[model samples]
Target: MKRLVKGFAVSLLGLSMLVGCTTQAPGTGDKAAGDKKEQITVGLAISTQSNPFFVTLKEGAEKAAQENNIKLVTVDAQDDPAKQISGIEDLIQRQVDVILVNPTDSAAVVSAIKSANHANIPVITVDRSAEGGEVVSHVASDNVEGGRMAAKYLLEKIGKQGNIVELEGIPGSSAARERGKGFHEIIDKEKGVKVVAKQPADFDRAKGMSVMENILQGNKDIKAVFAHNDEMALGALKAIQAAGLKDVVVVGFDATDDAVAAVKEGRMSATVAQKPELIGKQAVELAKKVANGEKVEKNVPVELELIKK
Candidate 1:
């Protein structure tokens, strides 16, 4: 009887030890620190997702956010400055760890950026930049360089001596300003090449078609067209085709899928490819670094590629 009692006691002791080994006290294991990883929330305010480029940009940001275990709250400004301002304010109210903005208008977004600054939230601008207010970082392709490449390509196709139309993007946006500057820099140096018509399409396809139609009515001698983005380029192509005009070279920026397909079909002469996805992903990474109190560069530029047939 004494031996059996001792054996039972030993078995109980062994079971208790096994249970203790399997079940550790909360916050006392190798995974305690990992399990307690800080939950980060990021806010993204985009100018508009109506554009395929911005849509792709949002996808990239979401992918990075998922990979890093972050919660992303996104708002669309619908290309309205006031709406963009309101969106930023909403983000600030949410107490997000970081804010990422794709400004509708560089100059107009200053107040919104300042609002974020006042709230002590770090701001990272993607694609378009703000004209005022403090931004921790900016992620985008070199618009000036992309524009220069487009101009050079168009000039080469047209023999550097032809009437070309310039289709501008939204006014006051850094992309439109910088791209125009770079394009004019090259076109100005060539004496034979003249920009016969320049107009703003607001980066809208229908607007681009209408603008091109109006320009074509007055300038039938146009040999090529340079649009700020592929949406406009495709619209211009439609107008050109409707007019039964052939051999007119059309170059564009932001080589979206449709634009690339057009290039493959020989509908467009060429396009400057900007990786919207990469830009968004980098912006999110930068925002994460900022949230973690890590230093980041002022500007992160993704490379641009020329896509042609």
Candidate 2:
């Protein structure tokens, strides 16, 4: 009985040694941190899921995360810059390995990006850019080219000669800025095409409707409307119809599913198509590469298309 007790004690000691050699020390940012990692956490920040465009972008990101064996946490900023910054801060505290963000206010997100950098996590911007540094990469469509496409289509449709109004997107948004610049560069050069009214709609459908209604009250001679986004264009369409206006062409950006249907139904003249899904997918892939210490380009440009009936 004494010999058996001694043998059991010796075996127990040996087992303890083996377990200690295999187990990871309890701490943060350790090599074994990934060894026991059952799921990699990724953050997805978008403007709003209410918009069908962002819904598709969310789906693409979720699908990629699923395929790559990662857990995705998504937050909607509701087009509020403050909320966007808070959402990113929450994700960083969660210690997510990577973050994918579609900024509401590009400049506002800059500090959040720096915060993530302090945590040693990688941030990939999608659909929009942030002002300050610490961004690993950015993936988005060429908004300027999209705007140019819209202007080109409108010029062809109206023989490059018409009075038009522009319904701008939310101010301080990179998409709105670039798209507006592109459209102005084209329309400004054309002697016959005149943009008589340009107003900021905050990229809301209702605001777009109200702005269009007000513009119509003063400028009944407007022949065309260019909206920074499809949602605003849809709103403008309602206003134009209510005014009993006809033969007024309306063009929009971001060819969402609803926008495509609108085009087929003759509700909208045309839309500049952007691949939100591709943007989402590319953002995930870039995050993975950055986490793996791989280098990626600062800008990954997605193609744009002009959709017309």
Candidate 3:
């Protein structure tokens, strides 16, 4: 009977040791789970996803977020200022760590930027900028220089002595304003080049085609065309082709796939290339830095090049 009791005590001792080794103390497992790193969430507000350029930009942002283990929430404004404002407000309500915006209208976005400022959320502008808001950083190509490059190339191709139509982008957009400014600055200096017609197509292909058709009705002697974006440029090309026009030099900004193809086909004279993907990637990187209380430059300019075939 004594031997049996001793053996039973030894078995109980072995079982207790096994449990002590296999199981964690109460609350210890919960503490370990809580000690894991918290995820960072970023909110991206794009002007419109319909445009391929913004699509590429969005892809770049997504790639960066995935690589860095970040949680990204994206909303499309559909090129509506009000929609963009509401989108940002929604992101704010979600308590995102950072906010990135590609404003549809530079001036119209000021109110949204101010709202973000009030919420103490860092705002980073991508591709486009807000005219009157406190932005922590701006990531974009030098659009003015791009405009100048387009004008110079077109003038050279057209011999600097012909009537040209200017196809503008969306009104109140920084891209349109700056690009127009640069184009006119150079055209104004050349005595031989004349701007027969200038109109806004709202950075759309169909609108560009329609606007060009109207402009063609009054100005049949147009020798060249400069569009603020590839969409409008492609539209203008269609209009020119439909009109049975030939030898009209077309210059467009944004070296989109269609634009590059057009250039190779000799339909477009040239296009200014902006790295949309790089802009998106850099914006996310900057947002991450800003969210982590790191200092960064106020303005980061992406490089630009002129593509011609």
Candidate 4:
């Protein structure tokens, strides 16, 4: 009985050693603090999910995170700059490896980006850019070029010599600013083309309809309408139809699903098509690179196309 007891104790000690060794092996649970991270955490601060365009962007990001075995924390700003700031603050508190921000307002989001900078966290802008920040990368479509496409198509439709109304996006947004700049660069050169009115609808479909209604009420001679986004374009379309206006060319940007459907059904004349999903995917891909201390470009522009009926 004494010999058996001693042997059992020796076997127990050997089994413990084997278990300890297994745990200490490289790539096992007992990795040291400095080992390369097995999984990365990414925080996505989206502007608003209410817009279908943004929803698609979020889905793309989520998909990429899954494929890469990354953990993603998402917060929706609901189009409020203040909310975006708070959400980013939360992300910082969570100690996420990287942040992907879609600013509600270019200038208003500067402070949020600055906070991330102070936290030593890399920030990558998606879709819209911040006016001031230490962003490692910016992924988006060239809004200026997209605007040029929309303007050229609308002008051709209206014969390049007509009074047109411009439905601008939320004031101070980078998309709104750049798109407007590209549009004016072309429309300003044409003496025959005149902008009868330009109004900001805050990128809201309901507001777009109301603003268009007001403009339509005031200007019967307006020959065409150009909205900065598909939502606004659809709103303007409803107003135009309600007012029984015809022969007025309508063009919009951001070829969202509904907008594409409208174009196919001939409700909209044309739209500048942007791949929101591709933009989101590219942003995440860059985010992973940035988190891993990889070098990337400052500005990554996704391709844009024009969709017509």
lDDT of every model, 2 decimals: 0.93, 0.88, 0.91, 0.91
Best by lDDT: 1
Q: Per-residue lDDT for 142-231 in model 3, tens only?
A: 999999999889888988899999999999999999999999889889999899999999889999999999999888898999999999
What does the lDDT read for residue 286 in candidate 3? 88
9-35 in candidate 2: lDDT tens per residue?
999999999998777656643655445
After superposition, the stretches of candidate 1 with alpha carbons farther than 4 Å from their true spots are 1-37
Residues 1-309 of candidate 4 have per-residue lDDT tens digits of 999999999999999999988766675565576665789999999999888889999999999999888899999999998999999999999999999999999999999899999999999999999999899999999999988888888778888898999999888789999999889888888889999999999777999899999998888787899899888989999999999988888888888898999999988898898899999888888988988888999999999999998
Predicted structure 3: clash tally: 0
Total clashing pairs for each candidate: 0, 0, 0, 0
**Candidate with the larger lDDT of 2 and 3:** 3
For every model shown, what is its TM-score relative to the native structure?
0.89, 0.89, 0.88, 0.90
lDDT of 3: 0.91
Any residue pairs clashing in model 4, and if so which?
A: none
TM-score of 3: 0.88
- Best candidate (score: TM-score): 4
Cα lDDT of candidate 4 equals: 0.91
